[model samples]
Target: MRTDVLHAMRLARIDLTLVGRNTTVLFNVLLLPLLMAWVYTEAVGAEKIDGVAGRVFVLAGLPGLLLVFAVFINLVNSFTARREELVLKRLRAGQPSGPAILGGAALGALVLYLAQVALLAVWMRRSEGVTVANVPMLVTVAVLGVALFCLLAAAFSGLTPNAELAQVTVLPVLLVVLVGAPIAFPAGTLPGPLGDVAALLPATPVVEIARTAFLGGDHLSGGGAALSTGGQWMAALPSFAILLGWLVVAGLLARWLFRWEPRHG
Candidate 1:
């Protein structure tokens, strides 16, 4: 068991090194979202959504964007590139257990996600005076968000024919997670059945969970109420369950469909 953990750690270190050296990966992982946040804030300057500052609203939704663009899309491309290069094939034949192999491959993205959140938290705290209402709840949900998106990336990687095709393959999921969720749209603003359907989308609950931590309300109700930390966590339970459900589905698909070698070769 210790050997397997060591193998994963070594693999993760290599992946992180590679990611660091790639300028394109760094741009998407670090700069793209930063640009988006700046644009959103400028476009909606001083406007309030659900009684929260527009910048705060944008900050709360930033994780959802990161999940789609930074983690999910980038991981899909990375997995497909590795598979086409026969990297995964070699790894599967090596000492690492299956879960350890995948976990290690994904660790770079998880680390980046955490770094992005921490940096953004500092920026928001300085610029917007945003304070976290429930730090533990935020951390817990953010980790879950990363886990869910990583699983989704793994599952989608199986369907992507090559690194180039990842751009096309990830579009549907991007639409679902980014457009259908509260990131692009206002929370609890979707009307009628659209709202119900949006609630079930994987990213919906995550956005809600972030709101609960940062702004003190669930997705269905916009921020601006005082809830105890426990109450805030309680409000996010259903959203948490929704995200967990999607995580299970993604995990099953990844287990069933992931390919170690290139499809054509």
Candidate 2:
């Protein structure tokens, strides 16, 4: 209803304001990835990659991991903190419906995600001289990835016992995305079944989706093309299904496990 939309919008503004004021949240949401990108680029300049187009693959995959960090790690902490402080409890008794409250809480991260996407666009256009060929695919997949991770993040929030433990609780997920996925090293270059194994991780398809969008574009000349950033529409079906499958599974788990009230107190 119109009333729910209005309430959600208002909640989004309030959450955005709070996020803006939190320096730690702001840095992780905005600067950490920027720092990583800079370091990756600098390492590339030092011939650390040992492969041509390494920087390109790095750029393409960084956004997905960044999104995972922001939503899975940072936003989970935010929600957990609010719940522990009884904010969620108060909100539960509030006038806003459940959907509005959840939507609004997520809207801040959604904004940050969009901003990060724009930043990635600028970086690609200016530094790599590359642009996304399938703009719609880029946008759709990015949003879909965020939604999946955000839902999972919320589900995991209940597992975090306290605000301080959020970092520890999210470590497994961070490690999975960091070590499991082919972000720093190209998927194609991975030895043996490593790349194939990575495809099983959630972040893999998200990164592949974005990488395909850029490489599939006409701007960049190919150099170290090992794995196909498959351009054919049909080639993407498996990745899309995998991500959607994870999202559905996570949603089911969230419905069963997510807590609206504080767990400890």
Candidate 3:
């Protein structure tokens, strides 16, 4: 309703449209999933890891990876790009509030996520016969994950010196999500301290919720299992609580530490 929110919304629309038109964004959002799905299928098929199916391997993994890519990496890069381009600085000079500006940028990522979910849902249904068991929990994780990561991304942007380095900063987190989370096939089979640590990482619960929905609550275990014991609905409480804590902490940090312009300025 506020003028600043309107301006931010307008700017976000243009930014998202540009990204939509860009071939690179298309490839990352579309082609990368297909490629990863193929690579994962091949890798698993070539060698059986703990008796997991190749298709189930790909299914368990890709959605969580896509969420991380969309929410964390993409949003951080967008904020950094806008800051380096002086868009954030100029916006600060306008009537829009900081929340509006950040929220607007998040809208673009949310749209991308919706599209990605739809595509993945249809593909999984047809190809793998995968049915989401806890639809509400999955939706909650998806939405909250996006919001939490967007804020965290904005917070990380405070430390990022430039747009180019933004991508690099996000890569460590991405690797953790991709390589560390149990969503990555045999990662579920990992033993001892390494696996224990991975289970507690931010991406783990999100992926757990997603996997619970995909695998019909059978895969939920450890923290996820303890959290969801009362039923699928009750199990989600812990995941939501953790995610909410992240959102609050990250959102506050972003608000307090965010730099509207270049560090040198």
- C-alpha TM-score for every candidate: 0.94, 0.87, 0.85
Tell me the spans in candidate 1 whose CA falls farther than 4 Å from its real position. 218-220
* Model 2 stretches astray by more than 4 angstroms: 44-52, 191-193, 217-232
**Model 3: per-residue Cα lDDT over 1-265, one tens digit each:** 7776787677679768988788887777666866776676766663433334556646654666776777777777777888889988998788777777888877777778767767777777887787656667677778887787788788888889988898788878878877887755544467888877776677776776776665555455532232242476665567667677877887888887678887784
Q: Which candidate tops TM-score?
A: 1
**Local error of candidate 3 at residue 10 (angstroms):** 3.5
Model 2 RMSD vs true structure: 3.5
User: lDDT by residue for model 1 over 47-121, one digit each (tens)?
Assistant: 877777777887876777777776898889989999999988898898888888888866767788878878888
**Using lDDT as the measure, which candidate wins?**
1
Cα-lDDT of candidate 1: 0.80
Ranking of candidates on TM-score, top first? 1, 2, 3
lDDT of 2 by residue, 222-246 (tens): 2333344444345567778888998
Write out the backbone clash pairs for model 2: none
Sort by lDDT, top down from the best: 1, 2, 3
